[model samples]
Target chain A: MKRRLLLVSNSTLHGGGYLDHCQQHISSFFGKNVKRVLFVPYALHDRDGYTKTARDKFKSLGYDVDGIHEVADPVEAVRKAEGIFIGGGNTFRLLKSLYDNNVVTEIRKRVMEDGVPYMGSSAGTNVATISISTTNDMPIVFPPTFSAIGLIPFNINPHYLDSDPNSRHMGETREQRITQYHEEPNTPCVLGLREGSMLLVEGKKATLLGTTKARLFTSGKPSVEYDPGSDLSFLLTDPMRS
Target chain B: MKRRLLLVSNSTLHGGGYLDHCQQHISSFFGKNVKRVLFVPYALHDRDGYTKTARDKFKSLGYDVDGIHEVADPVEAVRKAEGIFIGGGNTFRLLKSLYDNNVVTEIRKRVMEDGVPYMGSSAGTNVATISISTTNDMPIVFPPTFSAIGLIPFNINPHYLDSDPNSRHMGETREQRITQYHEEPNTPCVLGLREGSMLLVEGKKATLLGTTKARLFTSGKPSVEYDPGSDLSFLLTDPMRS
Candidate 1:
């Protein structure tokens, strides 16, 4: 139980401001003692700009946030951090940065072994899962691998949405795409984390934290929907209970 | 100008039948003389089932279509093919299969060198580009490479959509994603082909064939919208005229 993770579906809600709904959760999860937060800003095209935006937002929440890029050593930055926050823009870019910086192992060690509180949204949430396989982002760049930090057992389809049943477009719906993914036997379960939804994980317990219901897709099994505030900790277990 | 290719944005229109709008174009492009079409059904989970569906549809158009999977040697089939059709499902799967079967070279030879009439929709259209980097599909599985047949001079965003101007979704918009891609500077132009649109390429000349206005994104240049029936062959040229 040496892990603390607050994985949010998105940074902003529809018609809301930046990091609107996630601020309170982040503050509560980190508590007042955590001061210096190491921010992963690689998902965006402009690292400094993205970090500035995140920094300003976190500043308003009474926390000192530093971009991992601002530091000379990414691994050392994570080791010295009181908390970690990964801002989402592009999952491929973020995952590649983790590998390219050679800090994937360091961050894993810091979070899993050191129990540094971790928070992520959108692409951040995608990387906190078992793999980056379920992300909805374009494959703009090839990553070294699809592997990600296994902060949680299941994969996350952040900013998840249902297909517009009435649209004439032929693109596969989010549901269809994930369904095809489960076509391969033994694939892990996927959580369709809709906008405004999130998963709060502390040690062995995890909870769905939002108004929207999360859709769980399991191979060879009917997809189930869990309401907000529902116990989703079992999802953190291997071969999740039905 | 030995290559002839028909790239469609999608297989079916919303609330419409499968491949309905595309049958005429397919028939006209292939004509009655071209029999024995080699179909690539590797994108779908059920290759045989997808082949059967396509066969029925193409048969009604007076064409003899055979799935590449049915042949003993896929390369041999492509070599003898009068034309080629790649059905849509998943781009990652299709590209992986193309590499796994060692048919990527064969198909490129047949299409780029031998001048075989080629048709692809959705995931199929995705591989017709320089790379699969612009595809909107999930990264369900890793392909050996993001490299595709390079049938076209530039990349494609198949099933392209304009971001909803009225709403708030934290996920990057189709435009934002492609624009971010262009930020890399050396990235090639991206043609966003909306549903119901098709691009017709014969040798070095290419034409947009549907009603949708294809948005072309080039770095350091404003995106231009090309109306249906416009000559896009200029897009085939290197260092496109501003």
Candidate 2:
């Protein structure tokens, strides 16, 4: 599949407006033929408000945007969409809404077979991987299964943060948590996609973008950090990636 | 049920040894009749090593500790145990192991109905509540269900931390994540048990212990912070607690 994806780590930077850092990247990814973007507001608590916000953002990019929920047939809207975008919120709730509407397979098929350019941030980026198992969000809702769109080989842990050794708190750090994951049988390779970073994929090539260094974790191997613009395409084709 | 419980928010302080801060408190909780503690080390990745460390600490406290895994029958061990201790690790893996071995109901029955003293730290503390949904750990493993021991009325968010408002990070803070939980339908009351804090439950009362303030969150109510030694027992009998 000639798939194109922009798996964003977060929607906004520390002090930037929503999608401000991503507007140019998104426009460049979609190109001229993309006159409309189908927005999945399922992750949001207030769907209407979220949709309206995303709609305005995309509209500023000179495209008409519609929330899949606003339409009677979400699957049909997905089928006819020029581009698709899934916003971030609670991953569990997002996956549950997808399963409840029976749209996971439809969205997966479209992004994989139809080769419709797809973009996701936070919870959205979580669903783009094998499963949303590494998400940092609370389990506010129960999804039918942990299965998700395997658009890429390895799992992406968006908005990843390292442990603060100086902090008085004793909670497990992100790295420690991921180490526990590797201890489990048959754990997948995980990319600790720090905030402000995004993974751009086209065809079989995936590149890590943004200024921050990202951490790559695999079992029985030492985790390594990669600088910005590193070629991460190896993850897309590694059968024993885990 | 005449249950005695000590739900510790963490196993260690910032620069302390494992369970070092709570060793005396644990000894007091178990009393002289509890000669041995059945330790559930399932939450830990290195169960054997973790049990060894915990055993050393408990041994110093003048008690024999048995790792449940070393025993032939985990359920039977819980049944015959004078006191049960669940050490902290990953909540998801711990609950999954409990459900897999059919030990949740047995342990719950023993601690809640038979009056066997029980204690849990970190992920362990998270499970001694209505559900493990409020845990701050990664979703490294999926439990068969979110159903937990239900020893307490509300859920416990162990090692809870507040938002660093001055930080440049864009990820949701602990408070925001819990608020997202409340937005979901039928959310239970969540107690943000800060590090160094714990809940001591006896008979019909539960009291907050240690130096830090614990955050209380309930739907349609402003989240409030409770100082140390606060009586939080009313939550035990509130039918509409959520």
Candidate 3:
């Protein structure tokens, strides 16, 4: 079986203190009896505050909650870990730190080459792309333009939500960003993911796990709506073989 | 002096009417006695509606607007052409027509190889990249994945406006998009253009026009603000020497 890669999002999470979509699904990839969990608190406003709770959750799950730090030795942590879970926070901040520490290269090697069951929340998932050009963050921090370990070819625009009528600051909507991507190059297939939706890439199969329709955008093609949990082998590689 | 390249924008234009930016600037490029003008109306909303008006504009300048449907035929039109202008509308629509008709190759050859004096508004300006993945429109219309002619390497986010307090939509701002670009695969600078602002590329010099400052995003570097019209020869190759 292919190692599981999971992304948990803060964008869609309601209230506080509960896992959104794909939270429990992490167990499916790493067996129910998985041990040794490393939770990254880089995104937390109160990194220390979240660390205690994360440690408790892992202890309840019968795994060790190794350590919680604003900055950790990513290479050493991954090297000694069984399963890695990166929780949600500001993507720009998390990625900037990772790039700064030179842990990005090691993390890619761990997941793509070593088959580590890698799981991330909002920003964690955003980093799984060739580049994080699609994230909804201000370029307050700059990191290198390295491709994510060849786990995926295209970029991911995560935590996608349509425009809410009740809100007030005017700017480009999530739909508009995808449109901008389409207007500029329109080649890479941009998956506009809803809150409950999760994209599962196992081996060559890319399975969408969610309850609603996810939109796919490609260059020169009309934007199409797709039901989640459907196998998208046709979109990637050879569909006929799948 | 190197041949002039002009870009006209449709975004941020209030209730588009007669040409304000195009006419005066374009007239200056070729001089008062303009002899040859080729208008690419692929970006206009109503192709037929704007095509006639564009032709009239050229005729008013005492220059003939060559070929309508043959706008894609760059080889024939670009030869000995004194001026090339692309009108504004939906860049996606314009690019779709360009890609479907397979005119990108001929145009790239004319601009990159033949060094024709090129002028484009909105969509026409957007097509000068390797891909149109950074445009500011809905992906409703399909253009080629890499529709840009790659006259420049970085992505162009045109008609960029800061968030207006009155309207409410949640997403990354243009500054955030450049930030995200800097965060990952730190390559190709992101140029966030406002209305009336244009990028002028002549031979080896790429200068930001109109705007006083441009935000420069690079990997591992803090995004710095640079004055517009600064000599950007570093970003370009010396075409004369090459």
Candidate 4:
């Protein structure tokens, strides 16, 4: 079976409701067969509130949302999940919870072997990548590792922002941070997914699906930009493995 | 011996030269006795370039700078150092090098026990605190632990920026990130040091230094602002230990 994923940059766009910008994409990605979504709300502090918001948004798209926290056995829930949706929050907290719940391997197995559909927004999209090294969120907690589910070979920097020319702040810009990521040995390519953008993957094919352009940074290479509908299947194959 | 530390928010101001905004503070903090300063340039990728910057800046202040990387033994370098300065770059890389070079404990001993004056800017200030959970830098690399030098009881969020009311970005504001850090169990208070601001510590007393005001966020407590002269010695005591 082919692995399917819809990795969203953010759950909400500026001046938009929750998942409003990507509602259509979500609907088509899950399709009619996936009746329920296993929502991982561990990234956030308030699981109930986050789950409710996700539930409402998924319900509007004709799908029921079941928060992974609500289940008696999280591993069993992931195994039985028709589809998986992870929302955005603190990346460290999300990855730590995924480890604490011992669901990282199970989720990977379900998505890779069982062909369960996987959907992630913001922090969710971060964990879907090979690692969360490119996330914009603060490291409020230390996870057991920086590794993630590896649904995609490359890392996604969700909500990637451009440097404001007028800003006087001396902190490293978003681009600078991603460039620094490449300084490490054996680092993977980083996709800077701008707000209102996402990547849709079916089998070995991946496409940029949104209104804005995404930036790609690879080691020893100049960063490039990609527009909506651009082919990104090349990112699916791990360069290290190849 | 008194634990002396100068934690700066950033190395440069909006329109100033490197360490230009806080030169006087650096001079007075080091005093006339500390003639040679050991500089830790591990936070940045270009060790030589970063060391040159630090050497020039400290020279202007009537002190000689020695890059820790230049020495054969980093731990020995830390032990014999008259003064220590860690410049800012990526926090993850900085902490990882500190552990990899086996200098975290040595630097801690040099400053906390031997009364060696410790100065850190940006990522440097981050490592002086309890943890790097509140840092704004990306996790380009994973360190063995999030634990840092416990020179201060609380954490410092250097280069802290206020949320722009006019901006459309949906990312978490600096305040929100620090608040999220408090959500973690046994977390320490966080001091958000804006650009051109720093924290100066001597013995049990810590004072807010530099031009701008600093914001303090304690768990379950309302956030408060502190001016340049405000007494922040209370933060020297670890509530977890008490």
Give lDDT tens digits, candidate 4, residues B1-242: 57999999999999999999999999999999999999999999999999999999899899999999999999989989999999999999999999999999989888888899999999999999988888898898989999999888788899989999998888888888888888888887888899999999999989998899999888988988999999898887763423
Give a tens-digit lDDT track for model 2, residues B1-242.
Answer: 78899999999998889888777789899999999999999998888998999899999999999999999999889889999999999998999999988898998899888999999999899888988888888788888888798888688899999888688889899998998988887777889999999989998998998878999998768988999999998788872464
Count of clashing pairs, candidate 2: 0
> What DockQ does each candidate score versus the true complex, computed on alpha carbons?
0.76, 0.82, 0.07, 0.83
Question: What tens-digit string does per-residue lDDT give for candidate 2 at A1-242?
Answer: 77899999999998799989878988898889989899999998999999999999988988889899999998889888889999999999899998888888888888888899999999999999998888998887778777787788778899999877667877888988888888888877999999989999998999988768899998779999999899998888882464
Candidate 3 lDDT, A61-107, residue by residue in tens: 56677653543566688676677777665555676567666767776
Superposition TM-score, candidate 3 onto the true structure? 0.52
Over B166-242, each residue of candidate 1 has an lDDT whose tens digit, in order, gives 75566788999898777765788899998889999988889999768899888878999999999888878862344
Candidate 1 Cα misplacement greater than 4 A, ranges: A239-242, B239-242
Query: Which stretches of candidate 4 lie above 4 Å from their native place?
Result: A238-242, B238-242
- Top of the candidates by DockQ: 4
What shift in Å separates residue B63 of candidate 3 from its native position after superposition? 5.8
Candidate 3 CA-lDDT value? 0.60
lDDT of 4 by residue, A88-123 (tens): 999999999999999999999999888999999999
Candidate 3 per-residue C-alpha lDDT over B75-190 given as tens digits, one digit per residue, 9 for 90 to 100:
56655566677765655567776777666776766776767777776667777754565565443344435447777766665665555555323344556555544444435655
What do the candidate models score in CA lDDT, each in turn?
0.87, 0.88, 0.60, 0.92
| Per-candidate clashes, comma-separated | 1, 0, 22, 0
